[model samples]
Target: MEIVPIDTPSLGDRSYVVHDGEVAFVVDPQRDIDRVLAVLRDRGARLTDVFETHVHNDYVTGGLALARATGAAYHVNAADPVSFERSPVKAGDLVEAGEAMRVRAVATPGHTFTHLVYLVESAGEPPAVFTGGSLLYGSVGRPDLLGSEHTRELAHAQYASANRLAAELPEETWVFPTHGFGSFCASAPSAASSSTIWRERQLNPVLTRSEQSYVDEPFDAYPAYYDHVAQLNLAGPGAPDLSFPRRAGTTELRRRIVAGEWVVDLRHRAAFAAGHVTGTLNFGIDGEFATYLGWLLPWGTPVTLLGETREQVARAQRELARIGIDRPAAAATGRPGTWTAGPISSFPTARFADLARAWQHRPVAIVDVRRDQEWRAEHVAGAVHIPLHELPGRLGEVPGGEAWVHCNSGYRSSIGASLLAAAGRRVVTVDDLFERAAPAGLDVVSRQVMA
Candidate 1:
């Protein structure tokens, strides 16, 4: 028996293909089904089943599409109100995928009200359970994705679910989870790349801590795009339309920028800060491109991608499609000068030391665009905490003056600086690590270590 993990690192989730020899089953695939198909082809295994642990809130699922393409049985929760046809599965149901592989659905409703974990048993290999968005490596799936009203109830249920898994599964059982690899779906960050049921029982907070203590986990804002993903999944998203958009020219790019549509530059932060088409936002294809772009772009707003090469734009399109941002309005690939006849806008990039030096000379409003947990952990003293997601709505709150934006690292701050620049604010992006702030002689403050 071989279990192959297909990772979508941008969304911080993993889908699994478990095969005995000739037949296989998949768990929680992303919207792009080609990757899964490639795995099946390489393994020389026919896909017999596709399973969804839950209706995901981070990215569109490709389970429906993959099943249709391969003639595999699409397995979804019996309780889920999905529009499309699926082999509805409930707790304790046993399913066979070829002669040698067996799957048992175990109800674990912490991540979502109808979440399930699949325990797969093969001829000789030890059992492995795919715990999607429930019991992660060292943490548990965040229960707040549904909303505040159900958060506490789900949190308690999550604790029960973790304990139940620990009590039922053997110590030798291998555990694989869909979340907690930097996914917002997890309640906390998990450092381990792999773990076993025994290790999780000994280390995971949900299993080790009291139910009350686990339920008290506080949550900050998640991506704004997350609000739409669950609905898209329930509606049965099909294969992504990934064909290249019409090649746009200088005139079309300018028109889109003037009309207030999103014109995203997919380049390095340094390249973007050096020079970019005026009014275009930098989502840097090298960074968390999809997560931030989907989070910041207003839902259904037309977007035009600007990249140095056609491949860069194509890469950005693939990432966007995972989060259900199907097609770009148009795309342009070339130098900034070629992108527009108008003057290209440029912003200054600085380091923490430069920020310290600048602070000694003039009044600068330091805008920290990290999440609340990051803010409370430690931040430069006197920095205004406006998370990147909230920056668009709360621009008026940033005090007037030359603004210096910084995140834990430079990725988010570059984004924040670009937004401020578009709003006509004088801004400098602190394009260095935040750890350098205190060493560079900036006053640093911390409320408490993040829980």
Candidate 2:
């Protein structure tokens, strides 16, 4: 049995293609199905099955497309009915892969009513479990992700399901989960991708707690689009009709950017601040890039991506497509000619030392782009506060004039700077000034850590 991991950078998602001899099964595939097809063809394997662990709420799934293209069966949970053409899979249902491999569906419905984990049993090795959102590396799926009323019940169910798996699987059984680091499915600070049942039992916080304790833990509210994405995943979207022409060069990108198209910077926040195409918004791949982009920009806005590297461009395109942002005009090569307005000037950033000195001479407007809770605890003296999400519409509040912007890190400041610059205000970004000032008398403010 051979397992290949396919990383989708746009969504910070990883999918697996498990092949045993000439038969292949794809697990939790994002919208880009061509790559999976290519891999199957190269291995001379005929696609036999596409399995979804659950109806996902993050991005569109490609299981239906892959199944239709290859005349393979699409399998999903049987208990909770979905709209797509899928065979109902319940516990003890065994799927055969030639003579060496067999997959057994295990109902694990805490994440969703229809969630299932596939237990793969080979001829000689300990069985490996494909735990989707039900069991992540260091965390279990958040129950509140479904909604408020069902949160406690689902969390309790998830706890019970996790406990059952921990007790049933042997210590050495390999665990492969659908989500890992950077996935919002689990809360922040998750561990790496593969872990053993023994490791999770010893170290996972969720595993240590009782069902009631797990359900009682407080959590932030789920995003608005979660239900929409979940429904789309259940009834898979049709094949991507990405009719947008492939961008040829910087010249074409600039024309689109000027024509009201959104230019998404897929680079890290720090890299974006160092230098980026003028007028472009930095939606780093780490954050909810696709969802936020859809919210901030008008729908169907032709997109051009500023990826970290050439290889990442396709990943970015697929990511946007996963959220239904299909018309990507092109990927930027970080060349000067890409921007018709030339390069947008970097915001004038100043250090705390420089800001202190300047403060003595004239009033320098300091805009705190941190959250309201952050502002209430501790912030720069007399600084105006505006969260980055609200900055675009509240530009009038920022008293323009050599304005200096700062966030916990420079990411938000860079975005603030772009909004201010687009509105014709001179701005500077102070990166990580909060972290740097934490040691000093400067009171760093956060919900968890109050100065």
Q: What's the TM-score of every candidate structure?
A: 0.98, 0.81
The positional error of residue 298 in candidate 1, measured at the CA in angstroms, is 1.0
Model 1: colliding residue pairs = none
**RMSD over all Cα atoms, model 1:** 1.3
Instruction: Quantify all predictions' global Cα lDDT against the true fold.
Output: 0.92, 0.73
Tens digits of lDDT, candidate 2, 130-214: 8888877888877677777888788878888888898898888888887655655664336475789999899888889766767
lDDT tens per residue, model 1, 46-165:
999999999999999999999999999999999999999999999999999899999999999988999999999887788999999988999989899999999999998888998999
- Name the candidate that leads on lDDT: 1
- Model 2 lowest lDDT segment of ten: 442-451
Best by TM-score: 1
RMSD (Å) per prediction: 1.3, 4.1
